[model samples]
Target: MSKTGPDFYDDEAVFATYQRHRQRVDTANDTLEKPVILELVDPVANKRILDLGCGRAMIGKEFLQQGAASYTGVEGSKRMVEAAIQTLTGTSGHVIQQTIEAWVYPPEAFDLVLSRLALHYVADLVPVFTHIFQTLAAGGQFVFSVEHPVITSCDRGWSAETRRQDWVVDDYFSTGVRVTYWMGDIVQKYHRTVEDYFYLLQTIGFQLEHLREARPQRHHFQDLQTYERRKRIPLFLILAARKAI
Candidate 1:
């Protein structure tokens, strides 16, 4: 048995489990599902882009399709990097295998850097944010999206009955929290409250620009029941911040 969200990309069985759920929901087509970070990015033609933890290259693909000058994706999982490469075959892009903690890049090399639903997996934000700040060019923007701590705190269970409620946060500051995997096993996830995120960006010299809580739109709700519930509770949060010169 493995830990930490079943290593979804590396483990075939775990990937299958996620794929099944994703298929049921048709995640790729959900426009309201436009990633919070991506909305802020606004990739322009002929600009260099870096996608950390690129995961299957979905966001990177969008950048290429929108006419980014060039794209580079850095992913930790070899399998995922391969999948990204396959997805972008014959396209103008490069995918490399590396962990965010250890990856290195030329300073001020990219115009835009993006990571979606990936940074929270990191145990510490200091080094990662530092890396992003150093790697981005002057006036470059770093955009990212993460599961809203409050929403994830409730473990994907916030129905209309539970809306606007207070739940005991066992350890809001605990660095270690258990994340249940697809195989029903648990693993430690890094924990940081909303303040931690805000402070880290300020400390690293990033100017906060956009912040939005993404609630599944009414059209996404399967029925009346889900619509009422999600309206009061959002599932993800997207943020856009710029590195100051």
Candidate 2:
């Protein structure tokens, strides 16, 4: 069985580390992904939003606060959905626990579909992309993030005790599932080159609007050490695409 289910994401430490501290701490996301996503999507009031892999309503809460019409979040982890519910009580959106790969979407339902740092776990994106295209209204937007190919393309090839964050990238063209360590869990994520992502989107007939290899701007990082290290390589990728009107 593929480990990319609710079980992979339900751990208390993982949720606390990634979802909860995402915006609070000046992690890679706060310095890079958030700024680009906000700039690219530019959400207006009363737009119906579908949040795929909506982890704990962190980004969903922002949409609701900014006056979204509705925010329906699809999350695989039951615990994440529960946490989202707690945060979204008396709010405009509700979360459902379902894997993005198999989750049934309401036809032509949303004005925007937003996913952050989630699709990497999906080993195959073809079916899910098709579904996302079908779920959006004509001219609707899809904004999403993934672990950058540079980061995903190789195994660290170092021992657990190795402190060096250096990455090796010998197998760039070979695409398949990659196992990575995070929060003491053996997490499985898919790896695809930048060209592969663009090609797949084009093949699915999604109009590419913006592409960003997430990099921190000047003074975006509080710690100089973190900033310098991140500047050497891309951490995340944001793609904004649209369906034809």
Winning model by TM-score:
2
Q: What is the C-alpha lDDT profile of model 2 across 60-154, one tens digit per residue?
A: 77888998898999999988899899989888779988889889988999999999889988878999999999999999999999989988888
For model 1, how does the per-residue alpha-carbon lDDT over 166-198 read when each residue is reduced to its tens digit?
Answer: 433445565445463433334445556777787
Positional deviation of 160 in candidate 1, in angstroms?
A: 19
Best by lDDT: 2
- Evaluated against the true structure, the overall lDDT of model 1 is 0.70
The TM-score between candidate 1 and the true structure equals 0.83
Question: To one decimal, what is the Cα RMSD in angstroms of model 1 from the true structure?
Answer: 4.0
Off by over 4 Å in 2: 16-24, 158-164
lDDT (Cα atoms) of all candidates against the true structure: 0.70, 0.84
Residue 208 lDDT, candidate 2, scale 0-100: 93
